[model samples]
Target: MDILILAILIATGTYMLNAKEQRKRIALLGSHLANYQIEKLMEALTDGYLRALGESTDERRQQIWSLLSTTEAQLTEQFSRFAADFAKEPEATTRVSRLAMAIPFAEKILPSFTFDMRKALAIHARGIAHVVQNTSHLAPKDRAFMMTAELFLMQHTCHWFCKSKTIATARMLARHQTPHEQLVASVSADTRKAYLTLIKGG
Candidate 1:
């Protein structure tokens, strides 16, 4: 009877430890996936904005506007899914809240309204910075690298938002180097490649 009790206790302890470890892994994975989703959303928005800016015809611009609206709705759905996953983590929840605040205003601006591109870009950049700052507990190094890539994207988005969007302008923004890029370049080759792929939505 004593031996059986000890065996059961040992098994219970092992199972509890494994469960705890599994939770940690899930949380970490959720954080990374959230970052990836944010990158995809931002990339889609930036591309839409640039396309809209580049088009001389009102019909093409309206098409891009419609595309941006659809992308915003899709991103909002993705964010809700993320919030469900990260609901228990306060840091994650806070980061999600900050990121969410950036979406609605831009979406509410009608196609006929004179939109302030600078203001729209600022909202996203600010939210990204807030999220990056608040989410350091979950895979800090990876999050830091993601922050760098996001800021890099933000800078170029603003650059093109101000300048006339041409192939030359787009290529120039893509080619522009920042200190963040230099810093993140030293991350593991796989990590760097994944960051680029995520930002580019590939």
Candidate 2:
């Protein structure tokens, strides 16, 4: 009877340990799935932004605007969901890092319209990069993930910016005006300043 009781106690202990391990594994899996879903949403937003920029004709641009607006709404909804889900998890650092990384991509995907719009987008992008850099220092692994995300984010931003700028410049050429280099320069300068401020924690 003594031996049987000891064995039962050991078995119960072993079961509890295994259950704890399983819980940890499930939590980790949940975190990974959340990250994957956020990344997919970001990609969808980027694709929609690119599609909007590709529409050269005014009528097409209008249609693309509607689509892009809807995409933006969807992206916002996804982010909100991510935030709520992440709040219930222990991996707050990872969640914050993912959000920081996603900001640059979100800003990049915004539609460029007037000079003001371009400037706002550039400034916002720089600000987000700055924030990411600052927050990433707290978690090295998360920082690495953010850096990887930012690389692709910046690439897409530059691609869209260059294409849109070219079209604008061509249109200006047809109007017999020098391409508005000043506007680009000013916006670029503002973006750089915003990035510097972020780095300096200003």
Scored by lDDT, model 2 comes in at: 0.41
lDDT by residue (tens digit), candidate 1, 1-202 = 9999999998787666545643553465445455547557756765666667678888887777666656655554554454344344433212110111122222233222223332333334443544334434434334434444554544443332322224223554456544444534633443455444433334
Off by over 4 Å in 1: 1-36, 90-202
TM-score of each: 0.32, 0.33
Model 2 lDDT tens row, 106-176 = 22243121122233234444433443334334342233233333324333333233233344345544542
Per-residue error for 98 in candidate 2, Å, reads 14
TM-score of 2: 0.33
Instruction: Give the Cα-based TM-score of candidate 1 against the true structure.
Output: 0.32
RMSD of each: 19.4, 19.7
> Native-vs-model 1 lDDT?
0.45
